[model samples]
Target: MTFKPFAAPTALLALGACVGRQSVLDPAGRDANTLLTLFAVMLAGLIVLWLAVNGMMLFFNKISTRHYDESTARKLIVGGGIVLPTLVIAALLAWGLSIMPDQRAPGDGLRIKVTGEQWWWRVEYWPEGAATPIVAANEIRLPVDARTEFNLTSAYVIHSFWIPALGGKMDMFPGRETMISLEPTEAGTFRGQCAEFCGASHAQMAFDVVTLPQDDFDVWLAAEAAPAMATDGAQAQRGAEVFLAEGCGACHAVRGTEAVGQVGPDLTHVGSRKSLGAGVLEPTIANIADWIAHTDDLKPEVEMPAYTDMPEDDLMALATYLKGLK
Candidate 1:
């Protein structure tokens, strides 16, 4: 009958999980910090209002022995119900409005275009004055101390672009683009997720946000702009052959190779990314192989077809080649 023992542990577990790298409370960027400050101020104001209103009721109902005069009761009602709340709310609203401009500030130099798909993300980096974008998938890298702007849109249904530690959520429309800027002050890898519900795999649609030093980010951008790495091992060579043979090129692309397809996320530097299948699994050979054979099992309603009938050796070889691309 009593679930009190279970309730305490469950609440603690939930609270503990909230303070991770994905939390808004653990801010790493200017916009996130501003938002956190606003939240703190609003919460403080709300707490004050709650205590004041409840304390008045408690005093009259439980603590007070004598009834107050009509004038005193009228003053208490006006102050607690009308004047105090109005002042607190107005002050909080003004403070919130003051920080809105910074959240909408323009980017320093780097601009990123993100497209939300069925269950994944297509990321393109367009540095200032660049003619073409350097394309990657399911991972975002931002230079520290620079305000980076993201142009977000969805290819299918609506999706909300959100990096909780870095900034607030911006709704991504189908044909129209929405923008948000974030200036990261810390260099760390955090988690990002699609805040909007699109389909069955909405919960699995996630990405990694890696903030790097300016120099390192520049080097990475240069590397990402280049073609995929050459296959060195014989097993990897066989995997490349298998990849082309199986028509994986029809949907996926591997630069420097003939696997040119535009239907899915680019695999040019997939091996170097933090996770695979849009944060559904680690980028390990075993996991890759498992994903290839059980795509739908891992992420329901995903667009990619499972290669369940492929031979074991071919599966391993393909995973090996893809894993070595980094």
Candidate 2:
């Protein structure tokens, strides 16, 4: 077989062309760009080394033993093997370590506790000089440009907390706490997921980090800490009755009420949340109704059973009452 010196370059160009058309790479975020650069450099170096090694092996195999003895071939092989591998590995290690963010001091900022459950996340904000922590679930809010420290742990199973745009991942193990700190430089919502495989509903276990302005974050926190409001009008009032009658209180908690079950996400301010089903669906009346009707469809293998048997009118009323909880 003949040697193809241009093969590696052509293959790299082809791969680059394919990636250039991808939506994930087109408008690449900060973390994406960083990872891409790292991968590109590593791949290019490996391809070049592979081509060089294969070319040399082929050339030596074709040559005569009369011209080059065993000692010469051995020397060449040993030198190339030692030097090339050492250089490549050292360069890669240095490059990788250089890209990692400094973890010594991310600065004294907001402290937040993140606890991972089987299929949801509970977040609590501990602001400076606060008597009690402000608690919420599935979604997190932060002030843009403010450095935030997250103390993460798992309540049930082992999970990994990953928000690619902000920083790297941190593992959450039961009884063991890990910390991750990041300064969200932009005001936007970033998607996060459990990078580790946990259980049946692992794919649906997702969350969002919303970076807001200082004033907006303050307002949101104050509102979230307040008590749940009572539903008004005849339909909502009737729905509130349905909420209690349907036995929804078994696994849900509603502030200012007798429902104190902690198996599920707190419904004290479910109406105020941006999304439902642990960020699987938006917080719309229709979405809530669909989720309440068939939660398994929205989140497969979820612990919450489907309420499809419930009457349509009752479902609508229940959704309305839940939406009015804010």
Number of the top lDDT candidate: 1
**lDDT per residue (tens digit) for residues 143-190 in model 1:** 999999899999989999999999899999999999999999999999
Off by over 4 Å in 2: 1-37, 58-66, 98-107, 229-232, 256-258
Error of 1 at 288 (Å): 0.8
| All-Cα superposition RMSD per candidate | 2.6, 4.8
Clashes of 2: 0
Task: Report the CA-based lDDT of candidate 1 relative to the real structure.
Answer: 0.93
Candidate 1 accuracy as TM-score: 0.93
Per-candidate TM equals 0.93, 0.78
Q: Model 2, 1-326: lDDT tens per residue? A: 99999999999887674443122333223444565577788888888778778867777777633577789878888867777867887899798778766432354557889999878998888888877877778988888766678899998889998876666678999999988776665677767789899998898888877878888988988887777896798878878788888888888888777777778788888887778888788887778889989998878777788899999888888889888888
lDDT of 2: 0.78
CA lDDT of every candidate: 0.93, 0.78
